[model samples]
Target chain A: MRIERADFPTSVTLDVRAGQPLALVGPNGAGKTTVLHAIAGHLPIMIGSIQLGDRELVELAPEARRIGVVFQDFLLFPHLTVADNVAYGLRMCGSGRKPARAATLPWLERFDLSDLAGRYPHELSGGQAQRVALARALAAEPEALLLDEPMAALDVEIRDEVRAQLADHLRDFAGPTVIVTHSAADVAALAADVVVLERGAVTQRGTWESLRAAPATPYVARLVERREE
Target chain B: MTPARRSGPAVIIWVIAALALALLVLPLLGILLSAPWPHLPALLVAPETLQALGLSLLTGVISTFCCLVLGIPLAVVLARSVGWAVVPRRLLRAAVTVPLVLPPVVGGLALLLLLGRNGILGKYLAQLGITLPFTTGAVVIAQTFVAMPFLVFAVEGALRGADRRVELAAASLGATPFQVFRTITVPLVAPGIAAGAVLCFARALGEFGATITFAGSYPGVTRTLPIASYLASQTDLNQSIALALVLLVVSVAVLLGLRDRWLPGVRG
Candidate 1:
């Protein structure tokens, strides 16, 4: 995946190789989610292009971008049951209900959500909801995945467990994955590489170990301290 | 902490509130007290009464359906118009609100000028051999014109209040814009739509001015229950009160039943 845009204070350019996950860490209002939204085609890139392999994603509509986005809130459709939510993408792709449900079974089993298939989003725990959001996004079989603050919505006690599960899931998918988060723990657990975004521009790019050894900015230093704590 | 004591202003406020409640309730109380209770069954079963009742219900239902079909889309557009220029958005809102505040008789006159024979669009409709005024269709049109704002405003509020991020989530999941709207947006606002529909139906049922002015009273054709009740007032006061009592009961029953079933957190 490649994103190049010049609308920011400094030109922002990013690349993630296939099967490699990158975490974008930034302070609040640093435009971390904006980067994910641009890649997912939810926002327009005024002066640049987003390319997934050879396909120019910037010109496509969000639905046509073949990019899965797990939003900060999970955004599980409150009206749909767990099974139906998982099956929604397939249904939208013109699969019959029976076939969609059939295709959703593996995802449900993988996420350990089979028992909760009939339950609504309101009934799910935060951890379970996170898994459901991941399963729902992956079920669509998109070419790329963007997760905005995936662990932000979970309880602090469950974040580590959910992050491990999320990392496992990310490994199983072949697409380039980008996670927008503030936590250094998320970077350590889920991403192969870390990109520090500040004020809509990438300030540093390296593996978590390298970033920890030599932090780029005060914000990065604080993130490293928090991780140690 | 000790319970806050009611001040002198609070006592005065409570007294004024009771007076306001009485102002609203006394008329309905008078209707109930003056109704010919013993003769209600006989009066209600009369052919004229039954016809008016049936017409009112049929037109009310039809108009509500019309409002849903038309108003839901309008509400969606209006709610999504937040990105539009301030002047245009305000103009659109003001246009929608006009019928809500304008006198029903004026609305009827507007409809007449627009759709009545020899009127603007009505002249062309007349050329097409489709007269709208003084017909059953006119009653429905008038009712829809007056009652649509209720549904539009309600559904618009719901649409605006709905979490739009969920829609982006759906789009990211490869659901087309239309699919997201149909599967996610509509279900999210279904309760609002239901509440709006009930309000629209009640408004349509109680419609008197527009129906009278645009469609005129023609017994089974346009003389709905409210119009019939008004006509009966000139002849038999007892029968008029009886008809009104029927309207009051039906409206209350519908509001209570649907409100409890669909509108959670709205119960008294």
Candidate 2:
């Protein structure tokens, strides 16, 4: 599917395929998140059409667009238990309290949160909260998932483990996925189809391996190299 | 245990703390110690005392209900506005804080001016066959006007400090704005709201100036415990002291009940 924003005061266009994970990588302030937000229906698109699985999604509200978002901060509800957090969408969708709660069990089991389902979000570790956040998004069964900097909030040592876990989760998820990241390690860890964004426009789009072959900018080169100084 | 030793600046700090604590506790101590030695238990069973206590509870609960319904939305509007959002929000914020700064007597006068039968807008309300001033309804209005600011301040502080990114996440999950507020925002800020409600309820329970001025002291109608105490002081000093002792007991009970909920590491 193609997404374009003509009146963003900037010409922006993005192309994503079904069952593909597109990673947006760029320097700080490059508008990578902006594009992701536009697709997720958080940002207003002056002139654009967003399609998800042959359906126009631009007209939908952020919640109604059938897209899951995992924020950088995890954004788990502090007052809610892990099970309730996962069940939030189901509950909101008018599922009764009993069934809504019961529906989250399998998701909790998949995330290894079954034992800790009763614990509040504040009681979970950072990695654990992030996983719960992912499970929460997936429990709703959205048409697409938008993950923004999944590993950024993680500490150095836990990064690899979380990244691996997130990769595995994304692999089994049956929807187009778009991940925004500032770190090249995240790009590699996700092994996403590269969509290099620069100041609200897509500079390049291709497979990660192909982008590594010929990076247009030094920023892109560093993205493939995973270097920070 | 021996009192902690202090020297110089530390001594001064301790003295200040002690003085502040004493200022708070002395009145309570005095009320307890100065109560009439005879017929105190009889006063508890008195019908007039029960009526005032019941009226106070009723008015306090009603006023607090009004505060919650009104204050939370105002807090949200004030907290979320930008530069253009500033002017109107500032005016509203200033207006809410007015009842807090203005003496309750002046607040009562203001309410009388706006809501009394001869008051502005009262003429139109009268045409609608509704008269507000000097009724039990007026007592609730007066108490709510004075108490809602406390709820607004508490809820506003909590809303400002809340991580709104969670709201954005909620939005992305297909929740309507209202749904997100009900399901997520309300639950997270519930502690602050609870604190604000406690403050409003306590203030309303003791409200006198606005209630007496606007609603007028009518036994079993507008007469709450505070107003009852004030009126009782006019003729019987010991009876007023008895009333004061009763107020102190009620406050202590409320504090004890709510303390664990508000305080960390304390079980409710």
Candidate 3:
């Protein structure tokens, strides 16, 4: 997948290859999530094109883009049970309720969320909700996956465990994955390639170790120091 | 018990509050006290009273249905017009709210000017052999015109308060825009729609001015319960009071029953 936007002063160009997850790390207002939203076809780019394979994604509506987005808050459908939420995409794609439920069983087992199928989002813990969000996103078999601060909503006590589980899920999905985050720990655990975005532009791009060795911006240096700590 | 300890301002505030409460409660007390208790059952079952009650219910239901069919989409459009230019959005809002504040009689007159037999649109409609004024259809139209704003406002508030990100999430999950509206947006605001429908129905049930001006009350055809009460007052004072008591009871019952269940934010 390739994205190029040149309309604004802070133009951004990004490329992600299949089976290789990339982390876009930036401070708040650096437009990390905006990039994710643009890729997912939620926001319009004034002068750019987003291409997934040979298809032009910029001209397509969000649903037709076939991208999975795990929002910062997880955003589990509060009115639906865990099972229905996971099966929503299948149902939307024209699967009957029984068939969708049947298809969702493997995802439930894979995510270890079988026991929570009947429960609603409000009844789940932070970690449980994250797993359900991931399960829901991946169940539709999207061509690309975007996660916005996947571990941001979890408590400090469970962040490590959930992060490990999330890393496993991200690795298992064979697609171009982009994780937008501000945390150095997420970079260390989840992504192999790092793109440091500041003020809506990419400041540095490299492996975590290489970026640590030669930090290009003050934000990158601070991030490297924090990771060392 | 602690009257002596109360400050002067506190005592004055309490007295003023009590007076305000009495101002609202006194009229309801008057209605109940003046009701003819022994003849109340017979008065309620009277043919004219039943006909008026039945007409009121039918028109109220039909008008509320019309409000829902028309008003929900209007509310959704108004709520989602956040990115629109300020002037147009404001104009749209003002148009929706005009009927809410406009005198019901004036609203009826406006409808008449648009749909009456000799009026602009009505003249064309008459050419096609369709006349609206002084008909049961006119009562439904008048009630709908007056009460639709209540539903629009309620549903608009609900739509605005709902998380747009959830809809975005649904979109990213491969649900089309219309699918998201049906499966997510509507369910998220279902309670608000229910409350709005109830308010609209109650407003329609109590509709008098517009119906009288536009539909011109006729026994068993256009005369509703409120109109029946007003007409009965000139002939039999006791029957009028009984009809009013019935209206009061029904309205109070509906509002009270739904308030705690649907509108937790609305409290004394």
Candidate 4:
């Protein structure tokens, strides 16, 4: 969908069909997260609009947008057990207890966190917490998914494991997913059309092949150079 | 463990700690020791004492609930910026702390001026047949007014520490702000909220000056434990001591028990 934000040029757009994974790559402080926040309705967008399929999201609140966001830090509720954390969005749906909790099991299994359901966020390893967070976000069954700096909190050791898990999860996701990250490896892993952000503006919008072959802005050039570096 | 190994400074510290402990513990010890040993069972059996105790518990719970209902949202507001402007935020914060720092009696007078039957706002409210002063409702209000800031201040501090990014994550997850508060924000800050509630509950339980001055001392109505204790102090030292002891024991026990659940990092 076309998610145009304030001060952003109207011609510059990134459109995605359902189930298409869009990996947003940019330099630090390049407003990658801000664009994702705009799409998710976390930040105010003044001039332009955001749409998911036929529904205009610019007028809606964040919840009404039904956009699932997995943050960089995972942001799992420290007070809740892993099961309850995964069951969070379901509970928000205002369902009965048995069904709501039962609905969480499939997601926990999808994340392979069935064994760690009783654990708190602080109790899990970074990778485990990340999966739980993903599972938690997905339980809502939103029209779109946004991940800001996914896998950034992981140590160098577990990043691969978490990325593979995330990749598998993203592959089966049925919604338009936007992942905001500065990491080239994660961008490649998701196999998404690249959206390069620079100072709250979209500098380059294309698949990795197009963007890498002929980089548009200095930001994309640095990204491509960093890939070589 | 050895006397000879203890240096002069160490001895001084030990003496000071012991003296401080004695100063704190003596009156409480004396209360129990000097209690009517022969009539202890009878005193416990006294119907008025039991009623006062029960009333204290009920009023404390009710007032604390009232405080929570009105205070938590106020705390969240105080903690977070509503708009970019700083002046309004400062005003709101100062307003919350006004009831906190004001002498409880003066606070009672202020509430009277605003809420008493003859007072400006109170007169308008009276036309609607609502009189707050010297009523059970007034008791709850006065206690809530004096005690609410404890909860508000505490929960605000908790809210300040709340990771906005986590809230953003929840918002991104399609949680409305209310849902975010219910599921994420409140649960994330549950311990702080709990601590605040407990502090408010204890303060409400022991609320004396404002409650008495505003609500008046009416038996089984406006007369809470502290008021009961105060009135009893005029005629019956034993009953006063008993009530005071109950408040003392309950406050300490509740605070200590709640510490584990709400204040996790507190060391002995």
Model 2 agreement with the true structure over B1-268: per-residue lDDT tens digits: 3346535668898999999999999988887788886978877767878899999899889999999998888777767764456678678779878999899999999899998888898878999999998889999999999999889888888888778778888888889999988987877677778888888888888798988999998999988899888888998877788777787788777656654375321112
lDDT of each: 0.91, 0.84, 0.91, 0.81
Q: In model 3, what lDDT does residue B120 have?
A: 79
- Reference-based TM-score of each model: 0.96, 0.90, 0.94, 0.86
Top of the candidates by TM-score: 1
Better of 1 and 2 by lDDT: 1
Give Cα distance to truth, residue B47, candidate 3, Å: 1.3
Locate the minimum summed-lDDT window of 10 residues in model 1 chain B: B259-268
Task: Kindly provide the TM-score of model 2 when superposed on the true structure, using C-alpha atoms.
Answer: 0.90
Q: How many steric overlaps are in each model, in order? A: 0, 1, 0, 1
Q: Model 4 chain A, poorest ten-residue lDDT window?
A: A4-13
Taking the tens digit of each residue's C-alpha lDDT, what string does model 1 give over A1-229?
9988777653578898888899999899888887788888887888998889999988899999999889898999988999999998999999999999999999999999999999889889999999899999999999998999998888999888888988899999999999999988999999998889898788889999999899989988999889899
Model 4's CAPRI class? Answer: acceptable
Which digits, one per residue and each the tens of the lDDT, describe model 3 over residues A1-229? Answer: 8888775745788888887889999889998988888888888888998888898888899999999999999998888889999999999999999999999999999999999999888889999999999999999889999999998899999999899988998989998989999999999999988998899788999999999999999999999999899
Q: What is candidate 1's fraction of native contacts?
A: 0.79
Model 4 residue B201 CA deviation in Å? 2.0
Question: How much is the TM-score of the A chain of model 3?
Answer: 0.98
* lDDT of candidate 1 at residue B233, scale 0 to 100: 99
Off by over 4 Å in 4: A8-12, A215-222, A225-229, B1-44, B82-84, B124-130, B263-268
